[model samples]
Target: MSTTDYLTQGRRVLEIERAALATLEKNLDAQFSQACELMHYCQGRVVVTGMGKSGHIGGKIAATLASTGTPAFFVHPGEASHGDLGMITKQDVVLALSNSGETGEVVSIIPVLKRLNVPLIAMTGRPDSTLATLADVHVCVAVEEEACPLGLAPTASTTATLAMGDALAVSLLHARGFTADDFALSHPGGSLGKRLLLRVADIMHTGARIPMVPTGAITTDALLEMSRKGLGMTSIVDDNNKLLGIFTDGDLRRILDLRTDVHQTPIDQVMTAGCITATADMLAAEALQLMESRKINSLIVVDAQQQVIGAFNMHDILQSGVI
Candidate 1:
């Protein structure tokens, strides 16, 4: 076949699947709402079960539900008939998937699910099929035709089922009042979690690591502290260790323009007082925003008493991966 022919076939397949999704959306009814309510009120985890292609989609649905504030896990129907059936409980809600609603492994386990008094939710193309008839809630995933030219592949049908599963998961997520912070807790190792949960204190330099100079220190002494700390700036503090001002590379440039004697000039006379500062508890992402907005590179972290407790720069955010 020519390349054009292959492209044409692929496009036809996508068009078929897209239509299938549209049909699924139109067919949604009260059953979808009832399914969401069941999963939302479930005191136990959602036990997702299926066979073959449906099983693959069920696994993805289980993962989506788990990450979005719904506790859920997938189990193979064949295995459930063996010993995994013990995993189901009366308190749990069971989500079973079968395109034909007649999958042997899935059909055989409805009795066990019933015995356990578990609420069964079924996803099937045929509403009159055994699985659908036995389920407490039936979500119709019917498709007019398969994307395969031969009309034997499970392409469009599976896509519709997966989309329906996603709709259920997302509806439950909102109904449970899931927040970004709650999502961050479940995804602590990901970039979104770092941006949401990581605070300035977690990455900022503190105590001796924070380069600081006394208010009366000479400009030359402040430069020494900035150089030793490698932050390109030194915070100015009073006798009680309260923040007074900040001296940065920009300050040095202005001092040079004025031809001031670095060895004799006090830092307080040349420093920028009451400069931009951050709290230790502020998010590192917020610190990055403050720095970007002010066109500055560093910020002094202060406490309730306005004492310099920590210091951070853009490089710190980059190193900590909160950027």
Candidate 2:
């Protein structure tokens, strides 16, 4: 096939899958709600099981459900029949996936699920198929056509199934009032976790590390402090350690344009006063937003009395992996 033909085929597949998701969205009804309630109220974990390509989709669905405040795990139906069925409990809910809803390995587990009194939720393309008919709640993921031109591959149907699974997981996430902080608790090792959980106090330079000058200090003193701390800016504070203003490299440029003497000028006279400040408890991500919105590169961490407690710059946020 030519390059254009390859592109055309790819577009056709995407179009088919997109239409499949649209159909799934439109067909959603009380059955979807019923399925959510079953999983939400389940005292035990959600046990997902399927065969072949359906199993791949089921594994992803289980992971999504688990990450979004729903306790879930995938159990291969073939394995379940061999012995993994012991993993399912009466308090648990089983989610089974199959395009035809008649995979023998998946169907064979129905009697055991029934015996354990575990609630079964089936996702399938056929409503009248065995798995669907036996399930306590059936979510129809029927699509008009397969994305594969041969109509032999589980393409659009699998995409529809995964979308439906996401719908259920997100619905449960909202129902449980899951917060970003709660998500960060589960994902605490990566950059995503740092962005969600890292606070200003955690990354801000404290004590002598903070570039600060007394209220009556000269512009030269502020410049020296900035150089020593390597933060590009210095906080101006009063005798009580309360923040008065800030002097940055930009402020020095403006003063230089006026031909002001850095040694003779008081920082307070040339500093940028009433600058934006952040609190120690603020999320680093929020601090980043404040910096970007105000078009500034540094933030002074202050107390309730406006005392300069800490400070950080854009580079600190980036290096801390909270960007």
Candidate 3:
């Protein structure tokens, strides 16, 4: 085929699927809400089942539901008959997919699902077919035509099914009041999960690693602490370990600008007082935002008694993958 033909085919396929989803959106009815309601209150997991292309889409739908707060898993319709049916308990709900609503493997299991006393939700192009007629809730995902030139492929229908699945997952997600923190717990290894759940205490340098100087220390003493800890700044604390001020390389530049004697000048006289501070419990991502918005490179972590407990710089955030 010519290059223009490939381009035309791709655009036509996208337009067909787009139109299919638009139709599915506008045609949503009471059954969609009833399906979400049933899945929301299910005591056991949702068991999704289908055959052929529908089976592939069903697997993705199941995964999306599981990750978005609803407990779900995919079971091949053909396998449901050979002991896998045991996976679907009476307390569980069934989401079966069939474009024609009469795939033999899927249809054959409808009676068993009914006998198990479980709610059956059917996503089908044929609302009048056997599966839809047997289901407790029938979500119609019918499309006008397939994206295939021969009009026999599953393109538009599968896209519609996937879109409907997303709608169902998001609806259940909203109804459950699932938060990003809850999602982070489910996805601890993912980047978004790290950003949401990583706490300041997890990455902050503490104990001897925290660059700190005594309140009566000279500018040279503070500069030495900064260099020793390699955090580019030093927290000046009093006898009680309470934060007094902060001396950074920026303070050093100003010290030299005035030609002050670093060996004789007390850090309390030259350090910036009341610098931006963080608590050990703050989110690292939240800390990154505080640093960016305040135009500061480092932060001092303090305890309830206002004692300097930890400190970290922009490099710390990058190392922790919070930036």
Candidate 4:
């Protein structure tokens, strides 16, 4: 096909799938609620099972459910009959996916699930099919047509199934009052997790590593501290260790025109007072925002008494992988 023909065909497929999702949304009723309620209250994992393309969607659904507060895992219907069925417990809920609602491998497990008294939640295109009839709750994911030209591929139907799965997962997430911190617990290795879970205290240089100079210290002393700490800035504090001001590379350049004596000038006299500061408990991502909004590269972490406790720069945030 020519480029235009290919583009047209791709658009047609997207349109069809989009329509399928709309239909799935409109058809949602009490059955969807029942399914969520069952999975939400499930004492054990939600065991997802299916065959072929449906199974692929089931795996993703299981993962989404697991990550979003609901404990769940996918079990291949074919393997379930052989021994994986043992993974399902009376305390667990079974979510079965089949477009026709009559996949043999999936249907074969209904009896075992029934015997174990496990709640069955079936997602299918046909409400009257065997799986739906036997399920404790039935969610119709019926699509008007497949996106494929031949209407033989599981295109729109699979998209509808996945969307329904997402809807259910998100609903459960809200019902459980799941928070970003809970999600970070499951995704700690990812960037989003780092952004949400990392605190300024975790990434900030603490103790002697912090670049700091006393209030009466000369500008030369501040410069020495900034160089030794390599943070491009130094926190100016009082005898009690309370923050007084800050001296940065920017201040040095600004004072150059006046030819101020770095050795004779008191650090507080040349330092930028009333500088923006952060708390150690503040989120690293929040600190990054403070830096960007203030157009500064470093932040001095202080305690409730405004005492200097730690310090961090943009490079520390970058190295922490919070960005």
- Each prediction's total of clashing residue pairs, residues at least 3 apart in sequence or on different chains, is 0, 0, 0, 0
Q: Using TM-score as the measure, which candidate wins?
A: 4
lDDT of 3 at 103: 98
Q: Which wins on lDDT, candidate 2 or candidate 3?
A: 2
TM-score result, candidate 1 = 0.93
State in Å the error of residue 257, model 4: 2.1
Give candidate 4 regions above 4 Å deviation: none
Error of 3 at 86 (Å): 1.1
Model 4 has an lDDT value of: 0.94
Candidate 3 residue pairs in clash (backbone atoms < 3 Å): none
lDDT of 3: 0.94
Query: How would you encode candidate 2's per-residue C-alpha lDDT over 206-230 as one tens digit per residue?
Result: 9889999998998898899999999
Question: Cα miss at 1, model 2 (Å)?
Answer: 2.2
lDDT: worst 10-residue window of model 2: 81-90
Instruction: Estimate, for each residue in 41-141, the C-alpha lDDT of model 3 and write its tens digit.
Output: 99999999999999999999999999999999999988888989989899999999999998999999888887888999999999999999999999999
Q: Which 10-residue window in model 1 sums to the lowest lDDT?
A: 146-155
TM-score (all chains, Cα) for each model: 0.93, 0.95, 0.95, 0.99
lDDT of each: 0.94, 0.94, 0.94, 0.94
Candidate 3: deviation at residue 244, Å?
2.2
